[model samples]
Target: MTEDVPGVMMGFMENWQGLSGTWRVTLVVFVLVLMTAVTAFIVSRLVLWLERRFANTNNLWDDAFLHAVRKPAMGMVWLLGVYWAADAAYRYSEAEIFQANEHLLRLGFIWLLVWTLIGMIKQGEQLLSTPGKVQRPMDYTTVSAVSKLLRAVVIITAVLIFMQSLGYSISGVLAFGGVGGIAIGFAAKDLLANFFGGFIIHLDRPFKVGDWIRSPDRNIEGTVEHIGWRLTTIRTFDKRPLYVPNAAFTTIAVENPSRMSNRRISETIGIRYSDARQMAAVVAEIRTMLESHEAIDTSQTLIVNFLAFNASSLDIMIYAFTKTTEWVKFHEIKQDVLLRISQIVDSHGAEFAFPTSTLHVPDGIELSGLDQQGQTS
Candidate 1:
């Protein structure tokens, strides 16, 4: 291949002897540029056609992969053209110019390849993160973190390759990097802690992007927006954006409401003391209502009892869980249940209690005058 490259160039240049060295090089570059442009255009069309075909198919992996590679493939075409032009130009140029152009072209090609790999990794992460697509679906945060880590690895490897290509000793660079890394570790301890916290979060599967979580130790309660290496973003219920250190999740108990299979409904209703005699019937009817309600989860615990006698009323406890964890749906179910309970109580001629107190006056002793004075006072 090495011998054939020079032969091929010579054959192409045979008719261009009248051209000066600069013109010859310029003509060669322009031809290569034109070829690269045409090739890229054709390949892009071909890729679009493939994409259309992939879109029609049930397999999404291919579609994702095609999307990932399209831009990089076009970039590679231009890089190849530059590489060919540089190789041919090297023969006509001085040693210093040749070396510089050669190194520049090589580095460009290497980085282009790195970019391509990173794009593919990102696309794969997105594909894996889509819910119900994979056997074991990964959440968006985990996929994003993995993609970033992979891209970092690619960049580091590319840097090392670039250094080696530039004639740097790999062993020497590694030795220096070890010393620098120690210093960096000490300087960025908090960053590392947050990064490790994020790693643990992904591994433990405690919560994920879009999950509604509240921290017991902190005021952070909201839907997860994004989990980064050093911080996690949350969009609070009030629509405020909260930035929290990832390490906070490791130290605090995070309540993931999104993971719950059911939303709990624990309520206490008070009836007037005069209706105490009908408490048993009311409790039984409430229990029956819960059991028969389609929205309530009968598989879980359901309890209704005349639980306590308060100072002025009889307190009835109703504890149940709705089948749906969705906030809107759960609230609707709860409203329906409460309304039904109210209707049942009314049917039994029981009145819901309000805060009230009755004062007793002892018989005799001119209490009317004293009470009148007290009332006026």
Candidate 2:
């Protein structure tokens, strides 16, 4: 069409005036409808081909762009087709209703563009944080924050441009916003606080989604399921959902057990007083075992020593940390260590102590109340 613009325009004008009023409207609508359908078909096929092409590549932007463009492009095609059809009808019939407003036409395009950008951001976010989708997946919380920020920027810019197109002064609107923001802030202070609290969480990142978090200030112990702008959803040990306001995180001291490098195995075992001579060997052998054990981390303060002496037993402390932080795996490791320690004690002819008592009697004060089998004599 650009190759012969003058020829095409002259030919179009010459033939356009030659058509009858009814035929002109019908021809315009038919031609535009056909053009819209063709354009929409082309866009879909192009998008499909692009998707297949981008699927083989690791670049996420092309895939996201292809996914985000399809529906909006189709809608835009139909929008322009219908608008031009109406304009043609109004020109021939002098009808007031078929008059398409150019302002609304421009605004529609702006809105569609905004929708496209927002859709692209959403797609990009999913691709970024999804495990196995990318080589180095981002943290879900950080991806969500960045996506929301980008979307907000796109929407705000679109709104400002729309207002500017409609002849509203940007400075005047900003001034009004500044004045009204104070009133809104006072009225919705709690909401604002929560918003800012969420922002801080995004910035500081003390705990993120999937972390096992507990608060010392409140009875809140759970795995984080979601981190939203207002509330953070936690799934407790008992499989209950806990909704905590973002503002609460600001005041509470949270312990994220998920981030712990190792799980501790601290236990005290006692041997009978009869095994007093075996205590030193037991302590030495246990320390040696822990140091050589595959699961125990010897670098992190491993201590095995005689702790205290109970009434009937000699206490020994076993302080160590396991290599794994997983709860189930840690327990399994601890069990294996305990079993090994028990076997070590048994190998030395020592036994674990339980509560027992022995009574003493003076030699002459004891009278015979019964025979050897406790029969009265």
Candidate 3:
């Protein structure tokens, strides 16, 4: 195939022998460009056709792979065309200008190929992160982190290949990089710590993107927006964005509320001392209410008791878990349960307590007041 290239060019030039040198080169360039354009058009159409065919299939991976490659493949086609044109137009010329141009085209093709591979890696991440598609779907944060690492690997490999193509000594470059890396590591120790923290997070699988996490040691409590190499972005309940260092997750005790099987509803409802007589009945009604509540998780522990006697009231405790971990739904379920409890207490003629005190004086001590005088009341 290599030997045939020159022969093909020679035969083409022979056909154009009647044209001057400048006109002959011009015509060759024009022909190569036109051929490249036509080839690229055909390739693109073929890809689109394949995409349409894949769309009808049950295999999700095939469709994802095709979608990932489509744009990159088109770019590659153009790159190949340019490389071919450069090669054909300068096949016989030994000029430095032509050689440099050919080199640049080759480099462009290499970089474009690398870009395509990186794009495919991104698509693979998306496929893995998609819920219900894979047997074991990865968390979005883990997927994003892994994708970043894969892209870095792709870029590093491409750079090495590019360096080698440019006639640089690979071993020497590696040695230099090793020494430089040590110094850079020391200089960016915090950055490296955050990076490793992210790596540990990926491995540990503590919390994932979109999970509601609260750090007891920190003021951060919200849904995870992104997990990057250096920082993790969280969107708070108040709609404020919080950028926290990845390393912070390593030291903090993070609570993943999203992973909870049930959301807790714990409260102490105090009733007036006068309602003490109805406490047993109130407790029984609340217990019944919790047991039959649709949103409450019956499988979990449910407690409704007249547990304590306060200074001026009877304390009734309610502790239960909701079936859902959703923030809104959990609150809704909790509110409904509380309302029903209030109604039950109201039906039992039991009033809720307020801070109150009553004082009494013995009959013998009451006679000390000034007789018929406003001096002391």
Candidate 4:
């Protein structure tokens, strides 16, 4: 074995000596770099071809994998080619040069691994962004939370690997991590609260992406666009996006008005107090209008009646349910009902009531008692 080792070393030395000029060294490095670049270009084209092929197949996972492979191709090519070139450079049997080359190779490989993992994570996120087959059983909030957690795990693993390559002991690193995590938790209590709040939002299923939610803490009504780890995004009716912290969401009463299958609309109309019969007719007309309305749900009974008496008018409250929960359609239905009821009341010679207050005074008192008249003592 010892004789074979010298023979092998001599052969290796001969190969190195044959290639030892400045120009040869430069040529070797250039050739390695060019080959790496060519390999990277080929990989990129191959990934593109695979992606196009997968696009034809109508399968998603393959497409995502292809997309992920394209990103790390260059890094991987450089990592492999550079390490091999570095190994080819050691002509002497000295230990120090070999150690330096080994360290550099490990560092480069670590970097490549980190970025490649990141690329894969990016692809995962893109894939998870699409709704699942079961009509998105998990809400966006939950998906986002889980995706972020997985990403964090990837980053932590890469960091640990990098540290290990740098000669860090596993136990010492874990102890340091435990202390660091505790310190981070203490310093970022509110941030941790927000993260937990995001978890609650996902688990509770109070509202979902595209839900029209109103916050009790703020007078804002909008559709949910995205639910993130720290904040939830809502796109308002006015087309403005609002970002509110997940913790704030837990603090407020979130009214998910869009969750209902149908919307119940109730309104009260009034007529002159002197016209009781006319008020009853108005109620009947309102009820008939609601009953015949195409947008109203016939499954539920519509109610319209003279509810009470005001000082100047008789109050009639009308209650009905719209067939749709869509805000635009509900508004249109309500507007049409109001117009039709108004026309019916007007044709019956009864008017909608405007609230008024009346006052009584002594008959002997006159306008002259007023400050401008100056006629009473």
lDDT of candidate 3 vs native?
Answer: 0.82
Model 4: weakest 10-residue lDDT segment is: 1-10
Each candidate's clash count: 0, 0, 0, 0
Which structure is stronger by TM-score: 1 or 3?
A: 1
lDDT of each: 0.85, 0.87, 0.82, 0.75
What are the clashing pairs of model 1? none
Best candidate according to TM-score: 2
Candidate 2 lDDT trough over 10 residues, lowest sum: 1-10
TM-score of each: 0.87, 0.88, 0.86, 0.80
Q: After superposition, how far is residue 298 of candidate 2 from its true place, in Å?
A: 0.9
For model 1, residues 1-377, the per-residue Cα lDDT tens digits are 43345347646876787987778777776787788899999989999999998898888888888888888888888777766776777776745665676677779889878977887897799779877667777767778877988998999999999999999999999999999999999999999999899888878878888899998788989999888878889999999999998888888888998999889999999999999888999999999999999998999999998888898789999999999999998899999999999999999999999999897867775554445547733
Candidate 2: list runs displaced more than 4 Å. Answer: 1-27, 93-100, 362-370, 374-377
- Give the C-alpha miss distance for residue 204 in model 3, angstroms: 0.9
Candidate 2 residue-wise lDDT, 140-171, digit = tens: 99999999889989999999999998989999
Tens-digit lDDT track for model 4 on 1-377? 31243234345445675665544545555666678789988888888987888887746767777776677776777777665555544433344665576677777777666676666766766666666523345455566667777778877887788788789997899998899999999999889988888888888889888788997778868999988878889999899999988888777888899888788889987888767777666777778778888899978867888888777778888888999988788899889888998899999987777888877877987665457555454
Q: lDDT tens string, model 3, 149-261?
A: 88999899889988888889899899999999999999999999999998888789798888889987889899888888888889999999999998988888999988888
| Model 4 misplaced regions, further than 4 Å | 1-20, 90-100, 107-118, 128-139, 218-221, 236-241, 355-377
Positional deviation of 90 in candidate 3, in angstroms?
3.6
Question: Could you list the CA RMSD of all candidates, in the order they appear?
Answer: 3.3, 3.6, 3.6, 5.6
